[model samples]
Target: MGVSALAEGGSGTSYPSHREPDGSIGIKLLEASSNRKNDPRAYLYIVDHINPGTRVSRRFEIRNTSSSSQRIKLYPGAAEIRHNTFVPAADRHANELGSWISIDRPELIAPPNSRIQLNAKISIPKSASEGERYGAIWAEVASPSVKPGSAGNIQMINRVGIRVYLDIGPGGDPPSDFRIEQLTPGRTEVGMPVVKATVNNTGERALDLGGQMWLSDGPGGLNAGPFRAQVGTTLAPGYSAPVMVMLDDRLPDGPWQVKLMLESGRVHHTVTGTLTFPEKPATWGLPALLDSFPLWALVIVGSLAAVAVAFFLVLAVRRLRRRRRVAQ
Candidate 1:
């Protein structure tokens, strides 16, 4: 979800990384499917749905940002969505989808500060199952210090990859959607404003949750943010997770109209509510009454109800006047 870089160590810990000027090898998607051209996720990873017996191809690029030549190994590895995370298998393991994927070049020597494009093809057998499969196309580089077959030495491997989400079926792609269950406003221990949205994946496919939140109608009519939801939270079907958006610390804490939009590919949902942060740190406050409804919709309904009430009152007055005249 965030910018991926070379992951070091097999220590069973997840480390965050980004490309730097000091030389790093990286991987990226080079092309997206024509059918999925409009979907942002398609451009980031190998996301698609195809029949069991068909094959699909995608292009990707690997770059050597160092000053010296590097030996890069290309391969497909096992991956799974466990506990709402895309976990890559350890040590070049293979899954169903990973076995099906073939890189045109398994290994290559990359010149310094050079780029190489390669094609990865996935050929599904006729017996493939009718569900989604997960894997990754990885580019790994080993540290030069670790000589080959150095049994007693520790070998550090740094690799980057693009995720794969491939669904096998006979018909069209499955529906992808989600729902926002609740919104809570809070402050961090240091008093930074934050909003936590509980989201549920209510569809047949997994969701990559990402979106922006806007705050308006605050104290003194002040407004804030189109703040982004921290990326990297993925939800499997029937799963629920919290998506959070942190705001500027300088923002005042009372009665803000919040609008949040979340999506996975083309499926999107918008939620509106009223929130206020609590006075204490690391505390949460509930949304105001009718906070789930948009303000504009509420105003329209209220206006219609007022007109109906006025018309009924006018009829009542006329009927009373007629009764008085008849009695006279």
Candidate 2:
């Protein structure tokens, strides 16, 4: 996580800044330079987990805090998991683990406070199956070529990545499967009240869904709330994702029995859904149709609608006195 070079009177070259473990200031390249004994070069990078025709080579470091002469570059991109976080992919490239990675050197110049080590290698193609694979490990710097009356249009490429977790095996970790495939209790075209659900990854890794919901069958020990979902939901495997959970119009229109729960490590899951709420619409709006009944059934249907409105106001005042005595 480092990149900052737009140069000139502003003096470029960045993408590497650290010193946090209580010290402070750590955002020069996204973070990860926790001063490993005074900046052991952004504390190195890659993390792998073998088994699958293995072949590794990790090595990374690139410093040149500038004094002129700094042209770094390197590649391997593709890594995303939106929402459930784990981003990394700016100047994207390749795809499947950046095509199995390979970056010995594509460009470098350093000089002036120098420090440059490369080597990225990662060959796993014995059919390469199993699970987990994301990529990233960039480090570019060059920015200061835009003076001609500058208002440019493009040219502002400052990079700083570092995130690669390639695991391929049935070995240690890579099994967080998934499932919660259906909950759908709707209303949201304006009538907002929701609770959708669907999350099937089915194992082999990639997930970031979260959960919580509660409300049950109570009668005198009332209790109904604790709804919290809409977490960073990522799910990528057999792919499937959608997990809404909205409801709150003073909830309570019967048939509730919620109680959902969910997790992703050591795997956990709980389910029990049913949240009905549809029948307050006759163009609804009498305090939402008396707040959807049940307070002794809206006081016995409002006392039988006030005795049928006093029997239709005694037949409309006896037919208005027989049409005013037959138009006297």
In terms of lDDT, the best-performing candidate is: 1
Best by TM-score: 1
TM-score of each: 0.81, 0.29
Quote model 1's TM-score: 0.81
Candidate 1 runs further than 4 Å off? 1-22, 91-94, 145-152, 288-328
Q: What would the per-residue lDDT of candidate 2 be over residues 1-328, giving only the tens digit for each residue?
A: 2443210010011112322222111112222322222322223234346677777676656666655676767777777666545576564664667777888886777776656666677888777887667666666765666767768634556655565656688466555567675665656666655676766778776655556677677334345767767654657677787766665766655566677676643356767745565544322211111112224456888999999999999999999999999998
Model 1: which ten-residue window has the lowest total lDDT? 7-16
lDDT, candidates in the order shown: 0.80, 0.58
Over the stretch 229-324, how does candidate 1's per-residue lDDT look in tens digits?
Answer: 877777888899998889999998888888888877777788887888888888888753435664545788999999999999999999999999
Residue 24, model 2: lDDT of 14
Instruction: Give each model's clash number.
Output: 0, 7
